[model samples]
Target: MAEEPMHSLARRFVDAWNSRDTAGLDALFHPDFRWHIAVTDHGDPEMRPLNSRLLHGMNLPWGKAIYNKKETIDIFSGIFAASEQFSLDLRTVIASGDRAALELVGDAVNPANGRRYDNLYCYVLHERDGQLVLLREYQDTLLLFDVWVAQ
Candidate 1:
């Protein structure tokens, strides 16, 4: 199979994210896809997000996982639904044959929590059969906890 250009995939990703378009996001991924979010290392035990138990008992240097495409879509859909406003500001992106790396600033207001969820994210994507098959994301998990997890 031929490799897809990372720039094109990156653009579609950004567009889909900015618009909270779950279908568009779905179209960009392979049937078997995984989304991993980096665990913050402040020398503290991680309290898994109550809404997503997908990471239960799993911990890897790469991050925590959401097993497949459907779950990924479900989690993202929840985020979109709960947010009063959400968007990503792209900072930089670099791509090679079947891999792409992205840097972005996330801005969102979770009305449920009434807190602004602003974060810096770095994502590494791996493509298979021209669709994204794996993604490992790095971000400030502490901010994530404070905004969405802590009471």
Candidate 2:
């Protein structure tokens, strides 16, 4: 077996996310991939699984009831971290043989209460034969839920 380059894989992940390609996102995951995260829920610890990660990530219904969203940020680095861009940060990225991980932080300010939510999100990836096989993601549900309040 051989190792695939990490930067290339990173590019693919970002490409999928920026394009909002659901299938492309799924293409990056390994079948056995698992995602985990610890979040605060009413002062209690809350954990999410792979299936839930994907399901919850499908995006809120854009049909009606909308709120303000921060601009899309994409962080990239070339020539080995010579430059840093906060807006486009990969969220957070970790890549190794047969495995890769990322955290996409989605933050916003609630107009109703003027509260800000900067959540630490992450995506766990697994691959085989140079192709993605499994993927899972984790994010702060409370932070996001706080922004999209129902009237």
Candidate 3:
């Protein structure tokens, strides 16, 4: 069978996420999938403070550079569990060969604190055997801190 196209896979990924379908994610991700939280300050001055907060103030496991498949799935599961409504609006998708990039905005209401969780994101993904093998996600950490972390 021919491998799935990168564009199709990227759309499915967005759909799976919007629906909070962990089983769909399981099917889309390779067994050895890796996740990355893209936090860098070297190039973008706007990222400096957020990166510092994530690296120093958060002190959370998500601050780690890499996450294995189970950890990635678990983190998603936790987020879904915490929110009353969680969905992403896919803005753009660019894909070629085994690589894909997605631009999206997430909207959710976190029942825990009655706070609206709205954030923008960019995800770069690599595919292997038609399944996503790696995903690097960049998002607004300040909004994350405001909604989910701050008291």
Off by over 4 Å in 1: 1-4, 40-64
2 or 3: which has the higher lDDT?
3
Distance from true location, Cα of 86 in model 3, Å? 0.8
lDDT of 3: 0.80
The local distance difference test score of model 1 is 0.77
The lDDT per prediction is 0.77, 0.47, 0.80
Per-residue C-alpha lDDT of model 2 across residues 1-151, encoded as one tens digit per residue: 6535654676686676555544664555444433222232222323333246545544332222211111011111221132121222475567877677776764444455666656676766666655554444456565565554432
Please say which candidate is ahead in TM-score: 1 or 2.
1
Please give, for residues 1-151, the per-residue lDDT of candidate 1 as tens digits: 6534887787788899899899999999899887766453322235344445764443332233444789788878977887857899888889888899999999997677789988999988888887888777888876786777666
Q: Candidate 3: where is the Cα deviation over 4 Å? A: 1-4, 40-63
RMSD (Å) of each candidate, 1 decimal: 7.0, 12.0, 4.8
Best by lDDT: 3
Report clash pairs, candidate 1: none
C-alpha TM-score for every candidate: 0.78, 0.45, 0.82
Q: Residue 59 of model 2: what lDDT?
A: 39
Clashes in predicted model 3: 0
